[model samples]
Target: MRANEGRESAIRAYTRYETLTGHVWRCACRARMLESEQRTGLVVYVDVSNRLQPPLPSGYFGNAAIGVTATSCAGDVVSKPVGYAASIVRRAIDMVTDEYVWSYIEHLKNQEDLSKFQDVVACGNPNIAVASWMRLPMYGIDFGWGKEVFAGPGSMSIDGDSVILSSSTGDGSLIVAICLEAIHMDSFKKHFYGGII
Candidate 1:
């Protein structure tokens, strides 16, 4: 934690994902130079495997996650410390449970067009959609030939789209990758990983 007032001095605990996403959200919003009052959303994918009544079997290989958003104004992101965004992210994730999952499914069922479902959290500037694969067993995946050079959620086509993946070497490090506009890339790079041009 670099020196930034006494924001992080409080006795508070945050998961690695929460902390990173919170920081990234602040950076992304700052990079985009969004208005102070504009709504900014940090979309997160929450895993609902264990939240189910009967957990999915280990062999039940498939996506079991739901996308949630932790949103605040651009000013809030820039003004508040990392803990603010982290707390928002943590709250968003914690709000998802079995009932929430079921309600989400019902909402999906009621939707006339599923394509527009992501319009709320996933959009252009001031918004980011983060997908995390850190919990998945990815490093050991072999498609019958050999170890993969990289395993992730594929390329991020839109600005503010990002992915969090475990290191391929199984070294217990994370790869936090994001896609931003060319104009904003430098600023985002500076804020995301400082001291780098």
Candidate 2:
């Protein structure tokens, strides 16, 4: 039909269709496909830099307590078994340790300190901060009712792999969200939602 379509058709006929992620596949035409492009699985981590009123103490606010909001890329949040999702959120929060946060904060503080001293001689920043491994899981966001409007596992940051999720308003609600890279997202969805035959 169109020039690009004709080229794509030729590629499809000759090029192999490799399993890229989950239900998502990739043709030889494209070497790589990012998760954001395919809308398969995503993890977003946003540092809520907004200071709360009354200046919360570091220890009190450091608790991984937050809200969660699950929405499709279309921005319509599905309403079904939200409480179940809430539990998953709580589990994610309970899993993280305070030491990790403190270590990160201290590391950043050191960076700031180094920046201020203009003529500091070089003895490499010997600050070795080790944060234990943390895993973000997304195998539980299942909506058997008429297929979720827009279903996504979760997203997070690269350094900490922090599963960033919006705050949810409900009892026993947790604000943590487990985000995955595009690769993990596809695999996880298949285990939960099955393959697209």
By lDDT, the best candidate is 1
| Alpha-carbon deviation at 126 in model 2, angstroms | 31
lDDT of each prediction vs. the true structure?
0.81, 0.27
Candidate 2 — worst ten consecutive residues by lDDT sum?
Answer: 15-24
In the order shown, what is each candidate's alpha-carbon RMSD? 3.4, 19.7
Q: Name the lDDT value of residue 105 in candidate 1.
A: 94
**Candidate 2 global CA lDDT score:** 0.27
Tens-digit lDDT string for candidate 2 (1-197): 01122234444322111111101111100112222323211121222222333335665644333221222221111121222222322333333344544564576577936655554222111100111112233234566664344323333344212222222232422232323345454443443233222
- Taking all chains together, each candidate's TM-score versus the true structure is 0.84, 0.21
CA deviation > 4 Å runs, candidate 2: 1-95, 112-190, 195-197
